[model samples]
Target: MFGKTFAGSPRRQRFLGNRREVQPRLEAAKMMDRLTLLPAELLDPKYGVMSSPLLPTLASKFSNLLVDPWESQAALSVLLAYYGLSCVSTIGLRQEPTFGNEKLITTPIAFDFSHNDHRMAQYLMWGHVLKAVDALVDLLQQLDYLGDPALGKMWDRSLIYVATDFGRDKTRPAKAESWGTGHSLNNGTLIVSPLLKGNRVFGGIEPTTCETYGFDGSTGDSTPGLNCSEGHIYSAIAQALDIEFPERIDMSALLA
Candidate 1:
């Protein structure tokens, strides 16, 4: 694991708005300790030297050639399983198409020449999502080949969540060629795992206004008056992991 540390002064000033009144909560601090930092170099298949001795050295043999953009995720998954690690996080895997001597062409669904164009952005967003799923499936296939029952079981219990900053405006520009829109409060989250209790939506969106409404966490029933918050989302994750907390969360309806 990477042993990187950050100074409080810089992080607090830049990220926390230098707010002296705000302090870290005990629960948050404990959660931070559970995080394991993986080396960024592992993303490049060529640099296979792992810092953890518990990991197998054969990881160095994997090729990092950019035949596919999502190959990095598959490589990371192999190393994670070899080391018996539970979770991994990735960033910046989604990028716009590049054109040059070495071409990495990602065909856009629609071309638009505008500073705030949404067509190209939406195409790239879904493209990356699909590629990420493909990579996960590839990793699962490799784990099955290992013939290790325990590793296969761990894969069965694994979950993947993809979160974005915010939702885009429900309406697009009236123009035909180039289009853009502002951000909106209505957004949806994706949870991919076999451990979920049921395949049903816990919230609803108003057709006329394109606004989101909360739902009953205990019954999975619509709760138009109650809005979902960040705390509720975190509570759901804690419940999924079987972590006990004093907070009264209606996770009975959220998880199995």
Candidate 2:
């Protein structure tokens, strides 16, 4: 729904003003409030701020915030994604069987981190991650999770996943802050939902070598010598959400 998210914002007299050195910063301010396919009212930060205890007054606060280009677009996508579901679920409840059943069930509000180097990765972590956090927080609150008679209990059906490619080389020198680190096998993924088996880790990571290990798919036992592939994770989440798959699956280690 956004245009050219990866492209750098160009300079203009109205956006750039006199601070040529801060071209990107000033230009981002102009584009921050740009319109999208989502309704203009839904993008308003004040949606539930006054009535909801979980919401912070953020309407004017986002006006001049110069976020990463991709994140800037993803931030709005987050709202659209959540609200898209909210609209469908609301209308679906009132519609006859096939009338409102044609819409997408949901789509992840996805974004990429430019991990060219440690510094760039850190920038995205600070910029992109925080934006997503805020957007999600707003989503949970704006709909008044289980507070509205119409939308209550929606929380159990929702999930927020924070996934990464892999961890950085744990062996990187402590002083080598600027040195880009290589990918290490060990990493963590965060999934939030009441639907998931809470407070459980499916696999283990070796401390000394930073190597990751697998677990029994049938039973949630850690097997340090064995390794889990990405497929195991896929099966785990798919099973947790009751999503359909064609193959045999028994990764009960990740389900509730």
Candidate 3:
């Protein structure tokens, strides 16, 4: 089994490939037309790294270089991926191109959990959990930035999330001087903001006994065998994304 589930912060629902392939070419052409608009140095540093103007210069110097702008961008993708920068294309979500170039942007979903160990104890030590939440908030902020009159629209709709395989205890296990205190099904929290109607805590927690109870957190408050679980939190996320499934009440909107 997958242990447990919780509200996911900065959840990912996109990826990269062909959509990115066609983007840089159109984007490159756009850059060529705006030659007199502004100097390359004036461009944002991140975007400045790629200079369409130098394609001819580099081509003459290194004949092995691929001349197609998109192909060159693909090479850049390989380089970025090698450095742990994740790349994803929104093409799959939109199904049709509405923007000028249909370009792809890169982003990462970071959590407090350790990549080597999925244990809650290790996760608590990693401060990036809250940092990851901040990153998610920044992502929404960027979306709003593009919506400003100056930058224009970024994405029509964006739904962000924070989730985990299982719920974690607010109390640390080391502080409790106990083992296997992780994977708590009792109660976990999720934070959803601006993208949704409201940002409030959701889900409920059933009382849980210590590890002596065969690692079960059930206080006998619910149906047989169901104990405290993350299913309810995941259900709320699905609903926020407008995802519907025929099942029991996973999350009953305790907060308006």
Candidate 4:
């Protein structure tokens, strides 16, 4: 949900979990409370305060700490769930191993590239996207995350997959940019993963009509009349993640 509003702007992501205020403080303490094993009924899914199930137990204990409430059952459920986590973690639960410690975090990034396709003609659409990618790569390099064995970094373990709803229409003659275009099925996904054969395009764009052509899944060769779907890419990802299915496209050629 966090991203820079403009191209090349100095803004950054918001990480207000540790703030003294209510929301941030509670948000920061959520995981810790669970780790410490708080004894609250609301933490259980059957009696959760804000969920289809009781996702947190300590809600009953802390709800009274806050005054704002539209219903009698509100404060007790919320505060206990929020405050209990913080108190437990700070009291001596959030700790790292003596010699071995590792963490794996994942998040998704979204772009405003829906019907606002008019920005494509102005170069603004790709501008911010490219800049954001550049910044991410820079950070990865600084942290030695891009396959740096000498520094003991994870090395190619991280993957960045850029998805699109669909492609824009090819109505505009080959190279002529247009104001807007309808969605088309001729689109491709951009993936940055060590588990794939990098720097390769499984499909090619036809220059005459500016259309995309799929490739041969077996040989990874461009096939003009061929067609592929998002499911094919999903199969490739599954291969990389060591997942299995009874039926899937033969996309082994894309994997590393």
lDDT values, one for every candidate = 0.55, 0.51, 0.37, 0.49
Clash pairs detected, candidate 2: 146-152
lDDT (tens digit, per residue) of candidate 4 on 22-136: 6665565463443332344335655443332222322333232122121112222232323332211111111111111232111112233334434442264354344434433
Candidate 4 has its poorest 10 consecutive residues by lDDT at: 87-96
Off by over 4 Å in 3: 1-126, 142-159, 167-187, 195-231, 245-256
- Stretches of candidate 2 exceeding 4 Å from the true structure: 1-75, 82-131, 144-148, 151-153, 171-181
Deviating ranges (above 4 Å) for candidate 1 = 1-70, 92-117, 141-147, 150-152, 171-180
Ranking by TM-score: 1, 2, 4, 3
Better of 2 and 4 by TM-score: 2
Better of 2 and 3 by lDDT: 2
**Model 3, range 68-127, lDDT digits (tens) per residue?**
232233333222322223332111111121222333211122222233344442353233
TM-score of 2: 0.51
TM-score-superior candidate, 1 or 4: 1
Mind giving the per-residue lDDT tens digits that candidate 2 earns over 1-256? 2235624455444344556656665455333333232334445666422221211323322322232333334334443434342321111011111111353211222221333344544553445455555555555544544345576644556666666666766665667765566767667677666667778876787887676678898888988888667777777767877887887368766666
The best candidate by lDDT is 1
TM-score-superior candidate, 2 or 3 = 2
Candidate 2 Cα lDDT to native: 0.51
